[model samples]
Target: MDRLILADTERREIKALLNVSMDIDLNETKDFELSVHRSAWDDTYQYGGYIFKPGTEIGGRIGRLNTDTALETVKVCGLTWRGMLNRKVIEPPAGQDYRRISGELHEVMKELIEPEFEGLFLVSEADTGVTVKNHKFERYTDLLSGIIKMLKSVKYKLRITYQEESQRAGYVLVEAVPIIDYSSQIELSSDSGLDFQLNDIRNGYNHMIVAGKGELAERNVFHLYAWPDGSIRKTPYYTGIDERVYVYENTSTETEEVEEKAREEFAELMNRQEFTMNTSDLQMEVGIGDILGGRDYLTGVYMAKPVENIIYTTDAYGTMNVEYQLEGED
Candidate 1:
């Protein structure tokens, strides 16, 4: 029954699970921090699950026993990987250790994140022509936590993709925008649905203003897309002229890139209306970054993109819940 495992190494299984839960997000950690629950009885001699002591080299597996294979592993400090919430000990640096780098997209990723990830591959969609300045992470911060925070602080439009390492590589990809390629559109109605509601359409917006310090101070853009064919609504209906301001600091984003991202912000803003639907309709194949289009008895017709898609499973069956936001059009 060993459907879940926390391993001492990628090849060897260590702790067979009692229960496990994980959350994957588009704008969140690619190397997810999984929350696992081990039954108190599992460690007893009669029960038979291995004990995971702190500081052991830890890897994991989650699949049907003897049927599905384990997932690719990442090297993690076992002590920090322990328990419901893995909080690392914050300490100061022993020496003046210096690490610095500058280059194209891949090289920059290699210098900043590859060491922590090991053998992982990063795919960047932007032109490598743009350069990154040398950055030295401050001392006393946990390396992984520091870099991830740095990624956010520096303000790069990045989303991590978790994939098993194949041929000396793992996946860490960056894109110009969130990937929303729906193979096909799906429809849901009051009776034909799991859950549906319109939330804060008044917060919907058609404009974005991006500002930063230094040379490129501000860039503003508007969101306008062609009304769907044979549609009655000509424009977005909001309480007022909803507009938003986004800022990136300590960043070297070029003027052109700033303008481009500002526009993307405008499009994702189309996601003000919320939609919740049964993943069973899509055979549980629907995932984040997918586009969903449907009509509501009260709200009418609309198109949306999946921002948060959650799945729950036990030994036999699984259910998926997807939360969708409006998809901004051209």
Candidate 2:
């Protein structure tokens, strides 16, 4: 079995953990769980101690530990949760036509690293060459939500990594990478040694009434409509046609800003397709944020969706398995 190392915050090594499994989602935080015999419990595995592999930066800190006397085992959970940022706020000046890792975005990252994030996070200088339009962070907005919204505006996802043997060792590197479309290169089918199942459930409101920050009479409000063709617009194309209305509340006071945020959220909820694929028999590495092309012969359906979530697990017998959950429309 592969070893999972427990390191201190200063990048010092501790002991290797036993029976560990890790899960990483492209759009969310990473999580891990490990268990050992009751006699093997160590006091050094305290909360906030980093849990990672020796060569790579893919890991989190210990969040919780439980001792089970009935089973004589000690279980630990490593949660790479960013919920702490929910209490923090960031306000960057609104700008337009900003390139990735430059100008206003660079200032935003610096602020996030210093007084905002308290120097706990560092961002990479890798430029994805994706330009953003009307990039704005509402005043007093939570840092976590603002970062997610900003990345989504440019079709990028956030990845936190660490440098093991560089000048920046022990420092976390936050990167904004574009969602790569690999549909033209890798095609998965029944003939390609991949077992898959698709579930397309269509039941959701297509219309949204966004209420922005204000009192009863002065409340800033806007309307957003989601088309079946995966486009969001302020103007509705048809009247009372599949028009199930849903109310969305926003913290922005500007009507236009509220409409933009509402449209983004509404589109995320409505423009998704779910599929489960087993990659045990495949010979390639399928990463998160990668758009994979899949075709099912029985249903005659084709999908070019992104890998939103993935789980890597190693059993006690030294066998490793990878499972992927692909989502989003073609």
Candidate 3:
């Protein structure tokens, strides 16, 4: 647990006396509190350094503030700096209001981000640095929505940490590659495994028709995994399963590799994977996009990542009770 240390706006002087609590929730927004007891400007004791008021914005060595302060019963219910990303509306200069622009993910991040957010980290080397389509970022669209809509087979996350000396509060933007496997960087804690259920699996698909305008061959077939490592060695389809003949648009191509890759990526995501676990235990460091590998006595082994987190804290401090959805597909 980080000692509750608060600094002024100029990054100087820690607050005097107080009991404090904080929570670092993944995939969701959470708030922390600073408990200060004040009694009529006591000259007997040293006081009057940091004033905890509305929009008092304090955080340096300890952490940053997420939202402004809210007065409660002897506690200021201020939000902690957990990489809160609100929708930012940007309007370009006149004439260049909206033009079809194309750039790699890093270029977009460097230009739009990095300026306001100093603690930004990125996996820019992933997937040969990510390329987006030539699409116009509408003036009113948010930053994340514009980039996500421009690219395919990609996911991004903002990670916040207050765990080190210089890294008092660090925010990172993590992005996965186009044809990537996150099994290396993230895995579910086997010992932390609990009850889980998988839905939308074993859908029947003989052929996937990936269609777009002006394409001759946009058809792809599924593959069966056969290995000495005891993998599913047969076709993962059945007539009774009801799902068949998937049609994916905007990714249509005559090239076999392009079509197959798009179909496979979308297929795995749209079908065969969505795992949610109910556990009383979630590590303090376990983040939003961090992968966890788990196995059940009935369902074998699976790879999962948390998407949405719901947390409830009892005391002003201590580990929070959290319920998060750990899905199999990224």
Candidate 4:
């Protein structure tokens, strides 16, 4: 496996782009308020005096006013408010406390900012004779929209693996080599005129299509993977090669030959096969409450690459292992 190293600046740029891709801007009018309260009080203490008695040390009680001292109290009450657009709140610095009125405004802003990722694709197994349709057709924008929707819903982290093939001495065999993993996030626009919702998140599993281009003709299929908590590592694995990977039902040897021929033809025409995969494990993650009101919340997205799967002409095969390490900031 070949590992790709990203500079800190590059990582930051990628993160920004991912955030933009995942956040949805909304215009729905909604708001809430948070009320804050505060109070103050004073206390006194006794001290030893300099003077000493004939038989004992002396002590004195001081009656000094606690000037510039103030008691502070805070309470937040949520209130319903209205607006024409959704807005984000600029939180105060950590040390500063919010006043009752500001707290209410902050609450309103919090409610106004919208949640991200709202799209769904439904898929099921069909009979071999059923006609397949490409929903977006020729319009690239429409295609992009549909693809983005599918990707956002699935939270897919893309990996692009490339291989070079050679046919020598009348024998045909292909060598597959793993390539770079493309890390990305899908984002949708509320103004895109596309109607989607988060209902599917609560409704269990969903499906989506995976299209490929260039040198990928042998793999073409709709692969649906769900990651409820958006954990890419747990995303479903599918290569969209159902026919290649399985025995067709009720098919004779002749029929199998015909299918193979058709697959080869299709692969040739497309110039690249598109395949997809799904996973049930992608959606598991830590809950919101687990991170809220905590000293620090750390979450990571994990990915693994196979470094070596080599076959030598001497009929020898070997594997390679690679480890990752992080260095501290300079």
Candidate 5:
């Protein structure tokens, strides 16, 4: 008979089959709206590098390994936005006029929810406010909230781009991978009345044990729960531990004292052998009967796998491709 052995090659093949692949595109649009706006915002919030002015002088060496020389510095202009709204019709008394203007500005601000409006504001000339004419401003708070909820429910490889066509018109492209949510459940218990608990632990757990009929050989069993989002909650259950016996043969031990000494020695040898056998026989089996057969004397083990690589590439036109691979096991 051939002995069974777990091969590294087999394990590697199983791991490859279980791995996940993800692709994300950072930019996939003609209009680079989001990119431009993000860049502008970043540049304003974080200081951009200083510029040098023509004909200005500074005391320093500008060339490589040269003596001190004169240099010039120039400051970049800050970009900002301010808005003014004129009320076309306001039937109000003296103090109420301020409230009316506030109302009008609030309505005008609602138009900013449009992508074109945001893009225009990001790229428009400083201090130039784009005005809406003959347009009734409708609130988009619900729409915005719904969009955010939808985005969070799925996994996505996101791509963003920005484009500006004048001071008042532009668009952004947002391409994303479809999102998916999956879940699984597992239960752990034992027949020998041993208690178990798997609650409050965000990571899943695994259980291993040894069981079978007979004194010389026993079968190993294993159970695993691999859930990404939440931990498994389990109540304590009873599974009894099994004890084994070993018999030892002794020669030239006819005396009572010799027999007693031999019995003690034999017991120690049996204990060591059982420990070795249990360690070597650990196995993970999945089936209704297997799970029920060895519920007691089980030990829990938890393991995690991580993503290994993520790569992104872009061409001359700024189109991007992204690839990601997660390391895993079978």
Candidate 6:
């Protein structure tokens, strides 16, 4: 089993923890829990400490602790992103009007995030081949949440590299990268004796009506349709089939902005295939934000979906188990 080390806020090694488990998701912050005998509890194991899984970039911050006197055990709950990254809001820079900064993804990161983290975290030079123009950061928006939303808008994901034993030890490096596409390289099938659940959206919405800032007669509204050819249409299309309408409300007053937002919302509601699999025995070489292909011969269902979440656990005997939740159609 990989060693789970507990460290102080300064990244100084404290001790190894036992029976630690983690549930990490692409759309949400990582969650972890570790249980120790009551006798092992001490002041050093306080909240705000760091949790590191050596040999990997896994790191989390201790957030909560609970003691069960009857069971004689102390349970520790931790949150990833060093705890504060997920909770800290992107405040407007001093002397600036608002937190509206826009450019390429890397530029935005350098301008907005680097200084906030300074020596504690570094931004990578890797280019995700994505650009954002006129992107506005609202007040009270958490740093990680805002970045994640922006990356998802451009079909990318945020990757944080944690350093364990270097001059940069305890610091996290952030980068935006395209989701790994393993559809062509790896495929899981019934032939491999692997079991998975397949979910198809056959009765999902195909049309959207979006209302933008305005009241009654002055309101700007847009219509969008998800065509079979994978294009969005403002005119009526895809007839004969039942029209499932989805209504979206946006705060934007600009015509182009509202229409683009409507298209995005409609596209999100389009039919897609989802898959879930427990990969403990298979040891699948796929992680979050990676596209994984799967085929079920009995039902003739084949799909390549993006892994949205993973639950990983390591037992006392060092046996590790993994499960994945795959989402998105393309």
- TM-score on alpha carbons, each prediction: 0.40, 0.72, 0.48, 0.13, 0.20, 0.80
Score residue 328 of candidate 1 by CA lDDT.
Answer: 28
Model 2: per-residue lDDT, tens digit, 1-330? Answer: 356667776656676665544443323445666666667666887777776654343566677787767986677776553434455677544683222233444445555654654445667765565655555666657776677668766677655555454454355566776667777887789998887776664666677888888889798777787777778887785356656788899874455566656777887666456666665565766556667777798888776777765666665444557666666422
Worst 10 residues of 1 by lDDT: 77-86
- Candidate 4 lDDT over 146-209, as tens digits, reads 3222222223211111111133111111111122222123222223222222111133222233
**RMSD to the native, candidate 3?**
10.0
lDDT of 3 by residue, 1-330 (tens): 223444443323344434443333332344444443343122222222122211211221223223223543244443333323333443455787563555676666455544544443333434446555565665556554454444433554433333223535322334433422344554444455555555535443443444544536533433443222323323444344453555555444434345434555454634345666654565543444445445554556464544444344334443335555554423
Best lDDT among the predictions, by candidate number: 6
lDDT of 6 by residue, 26-128 (tens): 2344667766667656788867787776645466777898877788677777776534567678886788644776678987887767777656567777765
- Give the Å error, residue 205, model 3: 13
Total backbone clashes of candidate 5, pairs 3 or more residues apart or in separate chains: 27
- Stretches of candidate 2 off by over 4 Å are 1-3, 18-29, 54-57, 81-107, 114-120, 126-134, 138-145, 166-169, 197-228, 239-258, 261-283, 316-318, 328-330
On a 0 to 100 scale, what is the lDDT of residue 161 in model 2? Answer: 59
User: Higher-TM-score candidate among 3 and 6?
Assistant: 6
The positional error of residue 85 in candidate 5, measured at the CA in angstroms, is 29
Tens digit per residue, CA lDDT, model 1, 170-216: 23343323334452444655565445444435343433334533543
Judged by TM-score, which candidate is best?
A: 6
lDDT agreement with native, every candidate: 0.37, 0.63, 0.42, 0.20, 0.23, 0.70
**In model 4, what is the error at residue 42, expressed in angstroms?**
83
What's the CA error at residue 137 for candidate 1, in Å? 20
lDDT preference between candidates 5 and 6, better one = 6
Please give the distance, in angstroms, between residue 170's alpha carbon in candidate 6 and its true position after superposition. 2.7
After superposition, candidate 3 runs with Cα above 4 Å error = 16-18, 23-27, 30-72, 78-84, 90-107, 114-139, 144-156, 161-193, 200-272, 279-285, 301-303, 307-330
Question: Stretches of candidate 6 above 4 Å error?
Answer: 18-29, 91-107, 125-141, 152-155, 166-169, 212-215, 240-265, 328-330
Number of clashes in model 2?
Answer: 0
Question: How high a TM-score does candidate 4 get?
Answer: 0.13
Instruction: Count backbone overlaps in model 1.
Output: 2
| Candidate 5 local lDDT, 1-330, one digit each (tens) | 011111121111111101111112211110111111222222221122111111111001011111122422111221111110010222234553211112222233333323333332222122212222343212222322222223233332222233323443223323232322111222233342423322223211222121222333332221222123322112212223432223333334333334334433533332111110111122232210011111223344322222222233333234434333222211
Model 3: lowest-lDDT 10 consecutive positions:
48-57
